[model samples]
Target: MTGPVPENGQHHDLVARLVAVLRATGGTAAVCTACHAVIPTVDGVGLTLFTTHARFVLGATGPLIEQIEDLQISLDQGPCLHAVHHRAPVLVDDLTPTDPRWPAFASHARRRGVAAMFAFPVLLDDHPVAVLDLCRTTAGPLSDTDRRQATVYAAAAAVLLRADADADHGDGAVVSASAARTQQATGMVMHQAGIDAAAALHRLRTHAFDQNQDLAQVVTDVLTRRLRFDPTPG
Candidate 1:
């Protein structure tokens, strides 16, 4: 017996094929290419049913996804973030009632009606470049078959994202997916510190206004633990 092999053509084709399989299986899934940014693909369209059921639209969904990614980048905690960073899969059976590992995220997810989620990292050369995610409204684990399918899909998605990045940059230039993850982790940390994210944004804006520091640097400091938010005023 031969294992399933990818057909020729850039990675996106493989992703499309995998997504077709998922939809055939009647599961809700989404593919995020090139640093977990949701790509507009066939499989992606099928997965949007879940988001639509949750009331996400193009105008709103983009920011929501960005917020979720940023939370992981800023707080340095989140299944998706870890999955991408470690080039592995991370699954949460439930998000309601809070999980100690990601209290903020869990709470927010629960509020948004996300009961369960699975994040799989798509990697190349031990570096994660994209993610494949699945979710269910019930608090149950994915079956073995589903997990296997997700793994295959993630690998294919990574390849596709890389190809897209290559094409976008032209001439073999490459961008590090980790850079996006780092930015998200940095935002997550400040959010976890009980500092209002909006306020942190204000501080970031002030820093950008007063000093010539890059907003990314300020975010990095917050995430790396170099910057602390003081509750009491001096």
Candidate 2:
């Protein structure tokens, strides 16, 4: 997903603003807020920090976006993973069910009403450590200007993360918190569907993909009693 500079022209002022904001604040939430101020085309912003032994959801603008990241974590696939693994941006201008790259992740995100997705890896000291992601509710790739600005934002995130690594509470704490919630939902699936843990999780992932809904969302419904599994696909 590479492109030429946008015809509308460069917004260097916005890039400066983002860098200043990231420097002013000590957290990703503040950085996201700053992004919303400068970038008008994006709907949500997310960050994921990866280490050799653990992976964590660094920060995000809201619950929807956090869940989007969680879905990828649960399934271990998607554009975000691709970007992290390849150390390049994964830009899906128009996300569609026909795409086979991320069978489960793509379908669920599509159901969540995400029309476009972009993920860029963040590096510090020449090693990749995090991903900066953007989700668009409207269908299309980010403008060249927006994409360039995203790279700027990603750089800021990488710096802040390394500067205060101790503040983050090591051991994948952020991701582990979300993972615990997922396990609760998984247990619900097992009980309602009368299956083992592995089977129940498989059922949840399959059901979400088949229905084009997010895995975390389906799990939420089950926990809330809004949905139930009958030991059979329906």
Candidate 3:
């Protein structure tokens, strides 16, 4: 895998395309479907978000990626798992008998005609929020240009994942009416508490606990203006 550093023009073009995908209606699913078309070397793409309990696929480009991501979760091996857990990129030029990192998973991938893989951990505040898996049918590592472009895509994915989590939605789909309220209320707390993102979420959960209320209900009350956080002494 060899190529010159990709020009800024090309990188800018890719970023713009990814932005368009993010703005479209389908959300993560739309981004997954459109990304492969933009990156010629990427034969497939899969996105998975890591929750405290498990890793769930947000979207996948096709059957190949879908199958691979599931296998990674079930078998507990492969590039996606390593990337997220390690908070680093995993690039295997070829999946073969000698690849010690994920021998079992590689065997399965080989049977599926997947010759290579690249996985990047999407990070926020130095923590991995998700993993983006890129697969290829050809046996080789990514070229320099491909790596740079992939990094840009991974960054875009991090932003989208945070947005989805904040909005109480999964990809493009609405999560729930209550969940949406939670999102709005969290924003209110963020404003009142003069805090950053995580602090605002913490306030929401703490307020729910202190009030002996469901998180959504507390959020709803706050959103509807029936309850307010005191920013000053009354």
Minimum summed lDDT over a 10-residue window in model 1 is located at 49-58
**Model 2 C-alpha lDDT per residue in residues 97-202, reported as the tens digit of each score:** 6579888788878888888889888877767888888888889878777787788788777656665675654432233234556567778878888887767766
Best by lDDT: 2
Deviation (Å) of 166 in candidate 2: 6.8
Q: Report, for all candidates in order, the number of backbone clashes.
A: 11, 0, 0
| Candidate 3 lDDT score at position 202 | 58
Judging by lDDT, tell me the better candidate of 2 and 3: 2
The Cα error of candidate 2 at residue 109, in Å, is 1.0
Q: For candidate 1, give the lDDT.
A: 0.48
Candidate 3 per-residue lDDT over residues 59-170, each given as its tens digit: 6777677667756765678899899778988998887955688888888788878999999898878898778889988888888866877787787777666776788764
* Model 1's TM-score against the true structure: 0.47
Write down the TM-score of every candidate. Answer: 0.47, 0.66, 0.65
TM-score, predicted candidate 2 vs. hidden true structure: 0.66
**Alpha carbon lDDT at 231, candidate 1:** 45
